[model samples]
Target: MYGFRFEDVIVDDDAAADDLQAHLADAHGGKARPLCMCTPAGVPMYVAKVGEHYVIKRMPNTGGTHAPDCASYEPPAELSGLGEVKGEAIQENIEDGVTTLRLDFSLSKTGARIAPAPSGEAADTVRTDGAKLTLRGTLHYLWEEAGLNRWYPAMAGTRSWYVVRKFLLQAAAGKVSKGEPLGRSLYVPESYSQDNAAGITQRRIAHMAALAASGKTRKLMIAIGEVKEIAESRYGFKIVAKHLPDFPFMLSEELHLRLQKRFENELALWDSIEDSHLTFISTFGVGPTGIASIETLAVMVVSVNWIPFEHAYDKLMLDALTVQKRRFVKGLRYNLAENKPLACAVLADVLPKPVALYVQPPGIEQEDEDALSKLIGESDIPSWIWRAGEAMPELPLPSHDSASPGSSLHRRVPPRLSAPMLLAQKEGPESAW
Candidate 1:
């Protein structure tokens, strides 16, 4: 029960921290707008000006021994060495490799500036004119019931909390759109009150989405409407240009529209005809396999936590989005003939099975067979990908488990492509997950 709030009303920068803490006491659930300052040293600096500064953290730049997030004079003498705090878990990559997350903080203590950009451009980036407090660290931290981020202990996991929620809600929207829900236990926890439990799962999200467009609920609070509410009480929250935490999740109708736009950008296909030429195109899907949720994975890998919701609404909206980019480098390697494109159907039957096995966003079906043929032959997707799909399944695969095995209740999709195919030739190198 820890979070911050923002005022549509403006206040002096000096009072920001105190204002944040006071608001935190009232809301005490999730975060609102927090200042994001990235230092040149790659250190991401976050500040909540309390009476002075309550939680000061300086994530380290290297691993091994770690420390508290920041320095202070009041207490814990050892805590002064911010990077000296020992984490709860620390497994070295002694063997094949045990990736232990830790904080590595250091002052680049060198010349830095925000460089100038070319003419006509808004401004220069990565410049040296302005100094920045740089910081970057593996965020494997010590957690106590009363620790700062105890509310979200999973911060050390596969997805950032914001990323998890963004994709979780998005996935929920999709499941509900298909007349399915991840089920009550799988969505927004029941602990949520009417005031905050907007739509935790797909069903709730869908219901809430409808209420938003309906003029009847226009008088209600946005979170109350965006989230689930008792007696239909409502509230107002800022609708940022993109995804932001604490703001309620939009319903599936809204979800799909938003997701589709993201996929285009994420899939790197917003300008259907134009951009396709720039990015390697392929049909990817979220498969019904693995225990980790696709919603969680997609959010971590794609949205990086804060979802650009406004962009979720319109395909026209364009910004150099910061999304986790995935490539079939294996796909590119296996996808011989850079001249030809891949098809969705062919990609569906084959291709990206390895990546699929790991994480799929939640909607690819066997029934879309025609889509396979169309994508391979002549369809909406580019021809280069259409051709790539032809050579997709470079190797034979094990049987797909769409049905439940005797003792197993989980259904799963199999690896459609092989390492050999994924290892095929390519013009340039592709990004690894």
Candidate 2:
């Protein structure tokens, strides 16, 4: 278990759980800062009060300093799109335990007749000044803060809509965006139950009361939910989320086409994988007629365990990792373009050091391949590379000191092509989208 130093007290994670509240409370009151003793040089940490509980959070820019096996360890920001807007768009105030975000999109509409500007999925293709968070960047931030980007064998089959909503809400607790608390503007559909349908509806109505308030400017709420389906409506396309069957967000024909064009890769990936989920983060407002219309939105495809993957190859690699019970952190592309190289994942259970996993797409340009190689060479952590259209390489072996050689952790077999991969290959390199 990981150990932490709280002033003169030293405690392991398991033992600290019993008295964590007391220590965190004291830490919040200007007591000595807690240090994670994962390495010879301890990593500084701060106490953040998340709702009713106080938790230890690694200090800003200190994630790479922790040991690979430590829960707080994170691959360097440069390995992901997060490197672009870490301190600029998303500013963390360590003294106050609040993160202030600057958003490129507006939270409220001024004129009733004026339509919102066109916005697309912002996933890999969009480029910005790094001064504000795009819709997809915001989603990535929330997912990362909620700990959904990290996976372990113990997490299998334990994640559900209820858990996702809880963690997302908790992540937004102390976050401030555009001078308003993010929790007030964020809506995550609660898990549905026949026993509490009426109560759920009532609470949802109360929560969205601001959107229907009397004013020239209509307030907008950011909703994050799994897409159940996108069907034709009388006026346009309607998105039906998994939990909220009663609430369908409307999409105009123009926006629908734009969504299809901009996020063709994400949509294609979601369509190709039967068990995968397409998650949407959208800015929507409730009209006077009780209709919810989406203004701007972004989409992402996540695996069965809710870990985001970029393509079919990524999914195949993740499947192998999960099947082998390897612990790893899935990398995310916040605002990075598709051409840029980023680690697909970082293996945490490997011996000697963690390994950064890279999947080179087929027909990649020579310069891009060189850039990817340079990225891998620059990183202190080792890397495992897999080129598309070829057999996958064997995964790095996990530490035998941590687990028996006969255990699942010792199985470092290469991944076989799944149905999705076979389909992608059959359709050619372009179909890997």
Candidate 3:
């Protein structure tokens, strides 16, 4: 259990529930800052009122400061594509406890005729200006914020559509996109039950009523759900989302072809793996006839555990990691291209320090390999690299010396500084804690 220090009073997470709740409630909106004592040098955290309860949240961009085993510990931004658009496309308002997003795509259509741009084409390529997020970038952001990117041994077999929907909605609660509350425009399918079908459909229609508004300017809503199938419809093609069986989304033949061409790799990956899931995020609008048509869409392939993966090699690594019961964060490529070098995953339970895991594609170019080496060299975190054609290397084991008082692995408390010290050491002066 993690220990948190609210002023001079330290509280363990496993302490009496009422006591912890009382402490958190008292700490909320107070001058006394809460510190996560996960390391010798405590990491600053904030208390946010989530619904009727108060909860502690890590300070923005301070995830790297906590100990590896801590729940709030995240791999350095430089290890993933999050480094590219942290402050510009995604902005966090610390005072308001909200995140504002700058999107490259439109949320509302203005023309009389609907001609959706093929936004899914930018899935693996660098098509964004780095100042705004693409459809895939938004998906990555939501997945990461929902805590779906991290895996722990205890989490095995605990994830389902119900759990995913809950977390995704929670993540979207305080987010704003295009000056609108994201929760109002985002739809995640609820767990379906035959007895509650009519009520579920009624709620879904009510939530999506904006899309059914009559006018030349049509509003669009974002839908995220698991793919059941993409089969031929009478008009063109329709996407069947799991748990939303009665509400298949329609797409034009052109868009269908574009989707196939754009996400060919993702489709192939999903097809190659058994028990894997294909998740889709799309902007759609309902017509006067009550037909839902997709405007723009993007797809991601995730393991049975719902952790996203880029290729077969990534799945292999994830399988091994899960089998061995190691805790790690799966790295995601938001707007980054396939040619770019980024950690595939980061092992958090390893001793000395967390290790960044990299998978070099088969027959990588010499220039790319050199770039990968340079990236590894620049990082303070140790790395484990596996060339696609070679045998997998053994993962680093947890250190037995971590408990020793004088061991190098022992947590060293840096001299106490002011509360909320923004760690701009790695990211530049503009970086936040």
Candidate 4:
């Protein structure tokens, strides 16, 4: 249902690829009359030159125009950190197909710090303001922008590590981190396939060799990979990533113990899932023996759908909505810690506006209630609260049958919540849920 339009000429969806290319080139190169592409409904798009070929990309601030089934379809921006930093932190230069990002945090730190790097979850507490994206938030932004988080039924079992690496490399291009191009300091191994297995291994060895030779005075590099396991070893703990099965990154016993303690809640959440993966984003250095070890690392738990979740409550909520064939966007913690007043999820597709769902942590204290009330009041859109004390309430059903271009669901205005939502108390013992 999407087609290209240029200079008042519309190309049918079935138009030849050559024909589309011709029109894209013909529509004024730099300025004046820009070649425009759009969904059948006329949502504007732009032609982007990626490497050697021109590809159609959704126009900045126009992702909501595409139908949900379309590849360009993105959930409402209000749901994610993307909304928080659209103009200030993230700036797009559509003319060149590059996005410039201003990060508040430094990727590489100078001098030595007393403590090892904090776990991803622990880093949230260190945020100074909600507007700026933390280092972990920046990584989540890259993943989402790369379209890795988007999924369709047909893609099942078709996604491999090779595809992931390609997408990530593409996303890292033109991105700036701490005054350096992100690609310069980032290392993601090429996926190993049968024919290229040996070649891939050799390339990986060379890259690791370079990292190993990087002296202590050199800045630490960033590495992002799926965590396969953390097993105890003589030196400390070996971190095996799914993409680099043969190579395990080393973590010192002290650092490994600190990571475990810092992210115990996150680890427990990931372990509870049957179909989930733990993604580790860390600053690492290679040892003289070619063994790599983490300097500081952050961890995120991704669901079967590929969207990230913070807590077990979020996992349960998203799983329920996913089962009902509903579309929604997962909320990012950004700089806000888990204990903060944040929407757990934003239900998309049906609404006056997308509904913000806040899951109250069990056994809320007085200050927590105050924080929740303040958050609820500050939200610009409609919201709903699900408390831990009650039996899980029926989620607001999306009005799919009645939903048309502009139709909205029954909006449940969040109440002026004062008392803490009770947590389900076990009769005898007090335990963390």
TM per candidate = 0.19, 0.89, 0.89, 0.77
Stretches of model 3 off by over 4 angstroms after superposition: 15-21, 113-117, 120-125, 401-433
Ranking by TM-score: 3, 2, 4, 1
Ordered list by lDDT, greatest first:
3, 2, 4, 1
RMSD of 3: 7.5
User: Which pairs clash (backbone N, Cα, C closer than 3 Å) in model 3?
Assistant: none
RMSD of each: 23.8, 8.3, 7.5, 10.5
Summarize candidate 2's per-residue lDDT along 225-303 as a digit string, tens digits.
9999989999899999998999899989988888888888889999989999999999999988888899888899999
Per residue, candidate 1 scores C-alpha lDDT tens digits across 151-215 of: 11112223333332332332222111112221221322222235444443344444333223322
- Deviation from native of the Cα of residue 33 in model 1, angstroms: 46
- TM-score for predicted model 2 compared with the true structure: 0.89
CA lDDT, every model vs. true structure = 0.21, 0.79, 0.79, 0.62
**lDDT of candidate 3 over 1-433, digit per residue (tens):** 3478988888864467678878888887687778988787699987766556666777889988888766677799989989888999999876656789998877788875655555636543556757888788889989888878887665677778776776677678778987799988899988888988888888888888888887778998888999999999998999999999999999999889988988899999988888899999998889889889899898999999889999999899999999987778999988776678999999987865899999987988999999899989999999999898999999888655433444322332221111111111122221000
Q: Give the Cα-based TM-score of candidate 3 against the true structure.
A: 0.89
Q: What is the TM-score of candidate 1?
A: 0.19
